[model samples]
Target: MWIVLLLPIVAYIFIQIAFCRVKSQSKYLRNVPGKRPFLIFGNLLDFLPGSIVFLDNLMGYLKTYGDTILFHDGSFSWILLSIDYEFNEFLYSSSVHIEKSDQYQFFHGWFGQGLLTSSGSTWRNHRKVITHSFHFSILLQFIDVFDSVGDNLVKKLESEAGKDSVEISQLISLYALDVICEAAMGVKIQALEAGNSEYVKSIKEMCNIVVDRVFSFISPRLYKLTWTYYREKTALKVRGFVLA
Candidate 1:
């Protein structure tokens, strides 16, 4: 009976001791400033529920914390956002730190071990293979593709000039994508000419799913349970498009 009554008290004391240890360890982060992560929750409360609002909050937080900030979601993870020019150069130039972070593995389902999410020998090999495609001669050849896409974009813009303030954002996105399709994928998506492509629509949905996955605190569980449906659906559509 006494042990049962004291369970809550014992757990309470243990939690307090744990928090004290964590608070003491906070000094190890040094001059880096960020949200005060609470026990269990960490900085989960710092994140907004919606992607748009979360981005707004992130920008606001960055404004307050400067270019560099310690982003903590839980005791399990912490990311140091180093946005300064010199710091970014140092981070990317280092061969030792070439490994992608653990969080990037979450995106593996979408991109697999492709160049963007790969590391070590796999990444090195992928880089070598991809670099060949971007060789100076190959890039020079791609200039014609870029010019065609740009001309198409200009024609679309000119057509919209007489309209009451047309949105050029979609046109610009399609133009950029057209360039990428031709230069990188070795295919012509013709997204701008198509106007309403199923593949393009799927791509947009995939972007929204990615944003939700990346920004949410419960990314792993959320992705597998809810986000995975749209992700897989869109992924299948993209694959179908590529195969076609």
Candidate 2:
């Protein structure tokens, strides 16, 4: 009973320390410009509307802050946004700065620690292994797959050509998926032809869940209590959806 009572106190103390640490880190970036953060939520509220709105807001920030801005999701997450060529070159051309940002944690469930999510020596090794897969000659071999997929996409657009309005985004996503599966995995999932297939729908749903999770302000530990988490868990069970 006493331990339970002390739990809140312990948690509060831990949070205070973490908050203080974040504050100290921010002091170095004080000269960096960004929208003033809110209490606890930090700059996350600015990005909650959706990707389009977030991109609009980000473009405004770029105009106002002149790139190389600093912001954080919460006290524990400090992010540096830089678009300067020299800064980007320095970061990408060096092995010392190979760590990904906190946002990539959301991809852990879907991609595990593969190329997109891994870092340090693991990332280096993965990059080495996959380097040949993207070589010009290797990519040229997939031209047939691309040509077939492009033909399908053209036919899809042609069918929707005189419509009042058509949502081509979903069609394009399916097109890309079909290409990736055929070229990379050596399997034809036919995502465009079978748009409503369980494989295609599960992939789309998983993407939606991941995007939502990235913008969500809730604690990940509490994710199990939400429907989205359960849905994501179920989607991961889709057979033949090999995750790297």
Best by lDDT: 2
User: Candidate 1 versus the native: TM-score?
Assistant: 0.77
Candidate 2 on 1-244: residue-level lDDT in tens?
9999999999999888978888798888899888888888888877773556888887887889886887776637778889999989998888788889777878888778988898988999999998888778888888999999999999988998999999888899889989998887888888888878888878778888877876676668898899988898888787445643
- The total of clashing pairs for model 2 equals 0
Candidate 1 — what's its lDDT? 0.75
For model 1, give the RMSD to the true fold: 4.6
Which regions of candidate 1 are displaced past 4 Å? Answer: 1-28, 49-51, 163-166, 219-223
Q: Can you write out model 1's per-residue Cα lDDT over 50-161, one digit (the tens) per residue?
A: 5356667777778988898887665345667867899899988777788897677766765779888989998888887887776688778789888988999999999889
> Ten-residue segment with the worst summed lDDT in candidate 1?
212-221
**What are the lDDT scores of the predictions, listed in order?**
0.75, 0.83
- Position 23, candidate 2: lDDT: 78
Residue 43 in candidate 1, Cα distance off native in Å: 3.6
**Segments in model 2 whose C-alpha atoms lie over 4 Å from true places:** 1-8, 49-52, 83-86, 239-244
